[model samples]
Target: MKDSNQEEQRPKTTFSAPVVLPALLGLGALLAFCALYPEQAGRIFPSVQAWVVRQFDWFYTVAVSIFLVFLLLLAVSRFGQIRLGPEDAVPDFTFLSWTAMLFAAGMGIGLMYFGVAEPLQHFLKPPTALGGTPAAAKEALQVTFFHWGFHAWSVYGTMGLVLAYFGFRYNLPLTMRSGLYPILRGRINGPIGHGVDAFALVGTIAGIATTLGYGALQLAAGLHLLTGWNTSTAAFRLGIIVVVVGLAGVSAVSGLDKGVRRLSELNLSLALLLLGFVVITGPTVFLLQALAENVGGYLSSLVDLSLRTFAYEPPREQGWFAGWTILYWAWWISWSPFVGMFIARISRGRTIREFIIGVLLVPTAFNLLWMTAFGNGAIWMDSHVANGALAQTASNVDALLFRFFEYLPATRAASWLAVVLIAIFFVTSADSGAFVVDAIGSRGHPRSPVWQRLFWAMVLGLTAMVLLLSGGLKALQALTLVAALPVTLILLMLCYGLWRGLLADQAHSTQDLAPATSFWSGQHWRRRLEQIVHDSTREDVFRFMQATVLPAMHQVSDELRRRGVLADVQHDLDEGATVRLTIPDPELRDFIYGVRIAHRHLPVFTVQDASEDGRAQVFEPTTFFEDGRQGYDIQYLRMEEVIADILRQYERYRSLSANLRTHLLSRAPGHSEPMS
Candidate 1:
């Protein structure tokens, strides 16, 4: 009975019913309709897709252009220096791990599936240039680079920036609704916010399902070539989905640091190894020359390519335009919430400039190189080695990569290697996608249970399987594109919200006169040195919080109450004891000054604590504010000094509240206390 009571007392995973129920119901209805009426879906989806392309091709073109330009300009602007989290916060993951995870999540499967196919298709049938000519070859690579380059990353970078900026800086839930806080204020906690997250949740599932469907097809094709098995059957793909999704479920259970991180690193290592083999064995010099030429041609033609809708061309080029460029734009936009949110999750503590530049450049550089190695290598191999035989397999999109491998050194081994790489990419995509989906579904609660993540992984696999079985994957892809229209509008609004938030951030920063705990004078030098030198334990800090912090807070609360203000002193005993003084205000942010016990690892040069684990650490009483700013140690200050520090922070808050330009910021919903 006691054990049962303890089990019941454990915290349960909280799901935002507003977000989760609608997303699940909507996805269930869509998949059921597709399963029940596959034939109707088959006919209807294509018409809907074509109609959307014919009508909004220009909107997609222009919207993507705006995203790219906006990101570049923001990176160069003064607001670039703003950190995603507290100013003093450091990055959670190292540069290499962060880059690898993001790259794998962003475009891993697509690169494997399209690297060899896109270039060859364009080379054989150039949209405007004549086929089977040098011009077509250049145009082929140029177009490939354009599609996979800065524009795609910018779409991802924009969403990531919005989520990271609002979620971390404002101490808001890390969900889509947080980005709209400046415009909606507290209404983000209402039905409207739920709707946005629900929309994103449903769209992310479809987008990831589409990518996984493609990955499953390619994996089956690769297995067929290597094992000589009849992998073309629907049962084979179903098996592939089960196996990959099961692996993804395991990864999700292991969480980001263990499973996803290791798999991403391995995925990148294997990809580079394959790329190196091709570079060494294939037409090395020609491919290198083509890569350089491709970059030049892509950059020179970027503006025209960005805006070109093929409006003046005949129906053929227009159709190609709608099929290729427009399709890619829609696909990237639809996938942004998943990729963007994942990026944001891993990108706290980075400055806006660093985040944008890294997101825009790193993965893009690798993608350009990957496409060059596979795309240009295939094109060169077709003309020289295969005598144009490789070109014949272009129509078999799933098997094209394996067919390209057939013309390379150690064809069997390389084919299997590519298969393995694709499978891992499949797992990573599902793993990360499940994580992002669960986050959206839970409205970005940070402590969801492992079972919830596994549930999402299962859902993703089943959705892909159902669609694949019913031949509705294409229809779902089309629906995702239509969904991108509304997402684009939301993204534009997010841009506005982010801009306003940043302006307020800069204004708040400009008002900082001194550190809150910097009032120690030379007369208190002995006390300051004693506090810094002593390796205080948790007990010591708790004593300081009780003796020094609580008294100061109560004094302030007493004075405010006596002045007819509703001020209160609150004490919390959980997760490191805290004492806070709060002054309530309905029109603006409530003024909060808090002191909590914080622990840190002892520096290498410091005296060891000699704990049971042989690890050295120290604890200090630190000051925190209502806004998610970094705190400082206040253990060295006297109680009177602590009161003065609180008043200084309160003055700054009052000044910010009075600024007309920062009205949205002051009135925006703020945290009751700083986030851990």
Candidate 2:
């Protein structure tokens, strides 16, 4: 068996240069064009943004609404029981750690930027309620919640779920193309696959660039507030980008565990500290009331908010749909690749249900709370405390959070804390973005060259600076919105691919893998029971896997090969022993039965001798398979029983493989690869 070091040091195969090179060149060329001719870009950006919004606004609304419904259906369906990886796999991070990382995804930056600004903006120009009054306050919360709520998460959840399922369950590379494997199969390794991956990478870069732009501006705002610095200059904001991006480069080099994870935890703690202070210093009871009211209003109007297009409204009100609501949808869609794949990477062992619930609900609840506390604090200060100072400078959205803190006690300290939070969140965002972009450019290997990661970090910093100079908020919003348009169809196709892949996998795993009882029954059970009740030991388990379990698997492999199927047994001391049967398919789930020995700790109560039971550890020979079912303990089973188990699994695999080969429906020419 190869040691852990060998696996860790294993060189990855070649990345698709065709995919990586072209994507970077195209995106970089456009960014360069914008940088060189800001005048032309300024004119073209609005026109393109307005046209796409006018034409595809309905598509965004319907696509997002469908994604929410799709998630609900999938979560409750039979597929919910499916594991992201093999059934024996366990979650990499604890629930708390996972939830913290989810929150620290720099969404706090958005909340910090918009939590107050958006609500106040909506309240000033009443979307539905009376302007600057009680009804408008409630309406403001509802609108803001809609922007940050389920729709946004649904976009993210769909992408993450699809990527995780395909990557883990199928042993495919963890890239966006893997999500299309149901339709594309091996074609996912071809040019078309490269195109898909390239498109996702480009969108991710643009989204991160936009995030860096906003984060830098907010950081600058806090600095100006605390120190009375001249951050009104664009050079200062550009400097902030350079410093954060360099810090991000260092973190990216340190990798996810050492850098990103630690930083995310820190950011979460700081964010909670700030949130707690806001809740206490501000009107705590009123914030609570607003939270409840905000959620209620959102729930009641969700259907309308979901489906509303402002169709038939005047051109004036309709513009809000194109700008605020539609803009948010595009940003979330663009964000899906970076955030979705990042979430999927950390979520290897979770079930489909757990993943969907965590992705769709946990961060969203945090967002609503964060927004209510912060946004409502701003509104309350405007009406009853600070005398409309926020609205007077609403156009400078970046400074609103700093100005709001000024109304509270210890203004400078609060502003400085907010600045640090944004800066760390900025670094974490860039670190993760570079990591994800590396994965895309390297065909799902995040451990690409250190120079490659730093390269992308530089690109992000430069992109942010150039775009900020070219058009500021208009450029950021415009690029993200335009970038998301072409990618939307890809996201939709991924959903369909996920749907088909699930059905295909369900058929595969459900094939009749019933055990044969003749040889392993009666006398065999007695011998198995004798072994089962004994005090467990490592030597005993290893001996069982080698002498009994492996031989039984070999027997099955021989019989399968004799029957014309591809079957072989491979064993190693560290990698364990396994018999893998491969049954190929053209367009659907491939048939595979890889049964191997895995270890689990003995239950403390199951230990026989008190001395050894309390102290000495025992290992069990547990079986695992490709279908990701909870494997059985086979250490005590006879050779005949092991053979029966292998046969049973193969029966299920072949049954599904045959059906998928014969029955998978084809899509239109452009929708899927040519039907095999």
Candidate 3:
């Protein structure tokens, strides 16, 4: 971890080479281009945005395709060798901490904005593909879940796993190389590595810049919705920028563990409280029933919905899949690399399988719940009261939550709560984004200098202000996707690397060595042997030697011990005829010598009494143990070293094994160097 205090001691204004000039140049060029070609830019911006989204869609398709291909190759690669490292010593956070941080970091301002707006939009204009009437209550919650569920979460989870495995598991530096390290481990540290890192950095900044831009626009919209002021005014835009920058700066200065985590926890609690209020005061029965039914619908339709392209022929409103669904998916995928890297940083010590399941499943569940409760409420109102309030309010996404509150019994109270909720949501989302961008820009370390974090935060706020001034939310959204393109490509590469790494791990863990029956094989081994040496020993020593070394020697040794040599050894030792003697092949003799040296240097283990029932137990050498393995006082340093060595050896042998070599050679001809 980088030292926060050390960072603070440095001159705050000193900018790193990577950030200063490029940022200025990029910002200047963007402003100039937009100014010089205002009309042309405006006309082409949507098409450009659409093209970017399409490219993301294409990138995702390619990623999924490559992932599938890798899966096929993995199936034929060999069995059971590749596996994630040990899961011992992983962090165990309190449920409250876990839930709060995850909820806050995972969702963001988008949830608050979409919570009411998205569901209501779908209810008023239920996708034509569903063959349902507008405002049909049944389709309302379903559509909401479609947009917020597993598909969106999958993008986040996949990217996070790639970063986590490569960053933590491999001990690689935090950069795009780390993200792509599983695939390009040893291949990194070259021009190729620098190129990968540069690409990642550009994509990350662009994506984060775009997100901040959206956040700023949404913040402006929220302010307008609450204050009834025109945020379109230059003063309001500047004011929004100032407020965002100030908030981010304060949080950045406070440091991540204290400021960011504290804010996230508070935001999460407030969101839950708001949800609770909705559940209590709103149509409770309706919300629960809708949630249950929609959850079922989401599960059953998940596979088809995830893959739906929403290709409606130029007639109806392109269905839910294209207009809202695909757009959200593309947006999530674009944001994945940035968000994923952040998640990976926070998720050190977690298993790849665990991280994936949590990232994909937990967030999806929360999204479903939010959509069901809030979205179903809108659907119920439209159906029962015959009010067009939700439909009317949804014309502007900014006012959706406000309108939802207006229809409630305690309108003023609900409005106030909604305002608070929106503010916290906005702050939490901004903080999360700032944290993620800091991680990316810092090359994966969370302990970024306070000033560095503040810099990014300010840049985000400023960029967002520019976008808002230029057009508004649409412009911000357009820019975000545009920036996300390169990041999307990097993520695709990450996916390939993750698949390869996992398969390689699996292959190494399941290697099998058996005796050869052919004379050719025996001769092949004999040619490499230099000599054999014999030693006489007591029955106990002979038994220990045979039990400890024979099986391993069978895999590497050439010749059997000679009876005459053993007799001569026994005679030299002056042992009785009944005493046993053994002679190791020269290679085996070297192996034994190495083992003895290792044993001699082995650290001493001091056992402390930890028996709960007052019974002392002998050390069990055959069983695996780590520190705290037997009530936290065994001091298993030696054990840990031994296990680590075995794991390293297994990895080495698996890479060199003929089966894996053949498999890799078959898959990619010139790229078959074993992953380090």
Q: Write the per-residue lDDT of candidate 2 for residues 1-676, one digit (tens) a residue.
A: 5766765675654456977788889888878777787777778887888899899999999999999999988899999999999989999888987887777773767877887799888888756566899888888889899999988989988988988898889888889999988777789999989888888887788888878888887888788777889997988989999999999999987878778888888988998899999999899999999899899889999999999998888877788778899989988888889988888888999999999899889988989999899888899998888788787987789888888888888788778888888899899899989888888888887446577888889988888888888764466468768888877888899999999999989988896533333345467566656775786676777777777777876787788679886666767756545545454455545455554555555545432654473555656666665545676555656777777776777777656545635344322123344455
For candidate 1, the per-residue lDDT at 139 reads 91
TM-score to native of every candidate shown: 0.76, 0.75, 0.68
Q: Give, for candidate 3, the lowest lDDT window spanning 10 residues.
A: 590-599
lDDT of 1 at 307: 95
Ranking by TM-score: 1, 2, 3
In order, the Cα lDDT scores of the candidates are 0.89, 0.81, 0.56
lDDT of 3 by residue, 1-676 (tens): 3676676665544333463455456655665555456556566666787775554554554454443343334335542222233445464444455556666766766787778877777666666535225335567677677666666666666676666676665666555566566555566766666555554444455555555555555556655666787876767756756776687678767765677678877877777777888887789987887778888887788666555555544435443444565566557766665666667656666555555556666777878878877877776775566466567557787666766766677766766776666556556556666666656555555345566777777766666556556653354355556655565666677767776776666665555431112112344344224211222123433343334333333322222233232211111112321211233322111111112101112222333333234433222112111111221111122223333433343343334344654444223334445565
Better of 1 and 3 by lDDT: 1
Of 2 and 3, which scores higher on TM-score? Answer: 2
Predicted structure 2, TM vs. truth: 0.75
Best by lDDT: 1
Candidate 2 displacement at residue 487 in angstroms:
1.8
- The window of 10 residues in a row where model 2 has the poorest summed lDDT is 662-671
RMSD of each: 16.7, 17.7, 15.6
